[model samples]
Target: MLLAPLALVAACGGGDKGTQEPPSTTAVLVDTLFTFPSQWSSPQLTLKAGGTVVFMFEGGIAHNAIFRLNPGNPPLAGAPADIPPTVNAVVRRTFATVGTFPVNCTIHPGMVSEVVVVP
Candidate 1:
């Protein structure tokens, strides 16, 4: 009887030894040259603390996406420095802070997007 219980415990533990949790996934697609459709587009992105944002380029005419500080904030002066642009490429960034950030395309000046990171 003792062996039966030990065998049951061993069987339960052995079944989970090689099992792994699934990886987290997030995909945001940019469509067209400078226009992002609602299906895969986001006006504002909300990311969990330490969460990642995956920007996927769908059908587009070689556009770039860049992150920058909001110029409207009064605390800082001078134009905000542009983060390196991701042109026709999938970009992933992990946000560690909770704040609002402005993003735009360097190639297409009018194409803009926003990212909102939350704790």
Candidate 2:
């Protein structure tokens, strides 16, 4: 739990407070950029305990998004699987736990960020 908070839904878009959705169904987008601030979605993502995260590779180069135990360390004990590399690719992942989650681009090292999920 290094950072994504899904515990990771998007700041805006989708779901209702109490109508029929728990807000956990909301989706957030993190663009894979090749420059500074690699992840333009947010340095810190705040998501509901059962929210979703959409990793959008909208940058020039190919990129992959993965939820890691320790940034770039691959395959944690309990975490979402890694998103493969591709340009203009879209990955939608849902988190069922309430904790901090870390996301990184497998192809592009040093592109790291965190998401926080609140109860």
Candidate 3:
């Protein structure tokens, strides 16, 4: 009788809960040399908190990157300080806060993209 009740309890989730799965990592390609000189392949990226971003730069021009800071939101750090448009330049960043991080090319005009982090 006790064993039956114990079995029922065990089946009713009466134990320590398992750890929730972490958010999945994401990848964004910054190969605008082929698509358009002033645009990235994916203009908008959405990710969860602690999510990973893999920036793959495929170009032949000299281009750098920067995050356009908004006065009302937290800043996003860890972008590539220098991404010379010499073939394939890769930048990996992890967004810690939940906000919109707008991207722009420092050397090129109108090279804009955005990364949205959500919790």
Candidate that would win on lDDT: 2
- The Cα error of candidate 2 at residue 103, in Å, is 0.4
Better of 1 and 2 by lDDT: 2
Best by TM-score: 2
Tell me the tens digit of each residue's lDDT in model 1 across 78-97. Answer: 21334353445666655556
Off by over 4 Å in 1: 1-40, 69-88
Instruction: Looking at model 3, report the run of 10 residues with the lowest lDDT sum.
Output: 27-36
Q: Write the per-residue lDDT of candidate 2 for residues 84-108, one digit (tens) a residue.
A: 7767666677666677778777566
The lDDT of each candidate is 0.52, 0.62, 0.59
Alpha carbon deviation, residue 39, candidate 3 (Å): 0.9
Give all candidate RMSDs, comma-separated. Answer: 10.2, 13.0, 8.8
Candidate 1 lDDT score relative to the true structure: 0.52
Per-candidate TM vs. native? 0.50, 0.59, 0.55
Clashing pairs in 3: none
After superposing candidate 2 on the true structure, give the runs of residues whose Cα lies further than 4 Å from its correct spot: 1-37, 69-74
Candidate scoring better on lDDT of 2 and 3:
2
